[model samples]
Target: MKEDTPPPSSPPPLPVFKMPRVHKQEYWSFVRLVAPSTEMPPGQTAWKTTDAELAYCLKCKTTFKYRSGSSASIRKHMNHEHPHELGSVGREAAVKRMKNALASKRKSSAVIFSPTKRTKKINPAEEEMATRALIEWIAKCLRPLSIVEDEELRFFITLVQTMHGIYELPSRRTITERMQAHAQQLRSLLKEKNAEEVDFYSLTTDMWTSRTTDSYIALTIHFMTDFFELRSYTLEVASFCGKHTEVRIRRKLRDLMYTWG
Candidate 1:
């Protein structure tokens, strides 16, 4: 009997290549896009119809055509024909250009604004208004509370203070505490207003068990205002410790109602 032989391994996949941005001077130095042509010059081979775009090498007489406007064929040609030249000019040149551009940008931005030395004291009311506005903006935009500590944001605020009265930006902890306190105050006021204006309310509930076998319940109340407008508010979402029996659930509902009232 003949011994079995394993099949030959497949070649590794080719690397994906993307066309460099128009402003990338380093890449444009060796590659340039040209109008597509069916005819290759006298000595060249015939072109395929599948070619969507054409690019010619700047350093040599070779031209490449690729499907779907891909730059991979052009890049492969460079890798094979101009490996040493490409290595000396590609990644290193791009990185150096980016660094120089960023340094120039920083220099230009620095000269745009000059912070004034004369600092005026901001009043308590003005400071409170500014803090509330900042909080509101953060909440409305769904921004992380730690955005207060961002250097760019702080710089912009400093620029504003150069003309207006100076005020300190709140810390993350301060914003968190204020949000919690405001939420509690709003809940209290809602309960008080509901008691005064609503005669009866319809309650909706959802119960679920977590992956860890822990159960939780959510209670929501729907009521009509004196003006006949319907409104709904979520009362609580609490964890249930014991068995979720009817009696236990009833007791929990009663306790939640009492707490809200």
Candidate 2:
């Protein structure tokens, strides 16, 4: 019989490399919403961020945590936990902003503000500013591009504008249209650069499941500059039906490459 050997010694502990700490002020993206200078839903004290992505809510009364990815969740928590904070004016402001947003649209590139019965004086400048801010906010964090039809969210933004003096937001249709145009513009620019600057390219593909248990695959392209700097960008993602078998993956890959190639 073979003698039992002693277990291998444990690997040395990982070096205690201290990561540089991020100050709250360094998170300028959240400055507009969480900073004391901007709007804060009543009953909530100034918010603080540790990782620049997750925020600690003082209004929560305890060490309440929420992601800065969606201001909607933060508002939902406030509405449920502190309903009294969102007063009458806040609600009315929301309704007014929604109404103003739903007013007829024009062919101009800028967001139009329509004056209604309740609020006779509509400031187009403010409306444009608010629209730009809202769209930019949604785009920056990769939030759902379909935030236009989110009425409850529109109301929250309206209430925020009450203190921040931002104008009423645009309608969902407008938001969608503007985002599409902006995306197209960016795509055109990127395609031009890739065709001009890059000589050769490589591709990477990933198959994964979403929260809803949907299977999908994303394709990313990689290239290098004359200086040997690497660059990568996701070209597109599509649903990969059936099992993630190699055959199925190969078929999908063929389809995408044939189309793009």
Candidate 3:
């Protein structure tokens, strides 16, 4: 009995099993990687004419076939005809996709080879010098192109080159065009901010006489918080009555206050 008890036999060893090896493809299949489209809805084509029998552009009044031509042409038609119906992001994405596709196709098919030599390491000082020189040149060109003010343009270009490491600046024309576009965007943003009674708080006034003996009137808005910290915007011309009469100035101030409120 004791001998049998002694052999009360060790419990069977737990079975060891190997986990199934997951292939990269199988793993990726389970992962949702594609970012949600902010431009257009899925299963829907942008700028495609509605179910109406006749495709008429409300903007340009031009008629075209449904889903015909390039997306750009379609978007252009919509912009000219149905500008109000098109969303901003949708139009932008369509134009960008078209431009990118065209550019990618036109790009030279030459094979680019990275330098094999270790001696071609980038020198930080040289890179910085090159970046600064390029930034200055960009600033000078931006003013005449009416893109942005010299200082602001320089700052922006410098920031882009320094932060993003875009060593090769685009053509001057392209830079100017882009800057002009961004300036327009800035103006639109300013308009939106002005439209919304956001952070506006106080008023700044300045009076000056022009060459034509006209008393030019200028006023600025000051925005402040409960912390008494002054905000950054310069004085914006609130009124230009041509004469700085007290009554006119007061009326203009009142109107501005009303609008701001």
lDDT of each model, Cα atoms only? 0.67, 0.58, 0.47
Q: For candidate 3, lDDT tens digit of each residue in 1-261?
A: 554522212321222111123222211121111112334446765323222222333233334432322234444555554443344444465656655654453352233535562224358999999868767876876635444457666545544533435466799999999988876665555556655644556667676766776665555666754587666454344436555678888887777556434
At residue 176, what lDDT does model 2 achieve? 100
Models 1 onward score TM values of 0.33, 0.35, 0.30
lDDT of 2 by residue, 66-104 (tens): 354445544555566555334333545665655665442
User: In model 1, which runs have C-alpha deviations exceeding 4 angstroms?
Assistant: 1-176, 210-214
Worst 10 residues of 2 by lDDT: 10-19
Q: Which segments of candidate 2 are over 4 A away from where they belong?
A: 1-165, 171-173
The positional error of residue 165 in candidate 1, measured at the CA in angstroms, is: 12
Off-target runs (Cα >4 Å) in candidate 3 are 1-150, 156-188, 191-200, 212-214, 225-228, 232-235, 238-242, 257-261
lDDT of 1 by residue, 48-90 (tens): 3333365555577455655554556656777788875665566
Instruction: Write out the backbone clash pairs for model 2.
Output: none
Error of 1 at 72 (Å): 78
Best by lDDT: 1
lDDT of 1: 0.67
Ranked by lDDT, top first: 1, 2, 3
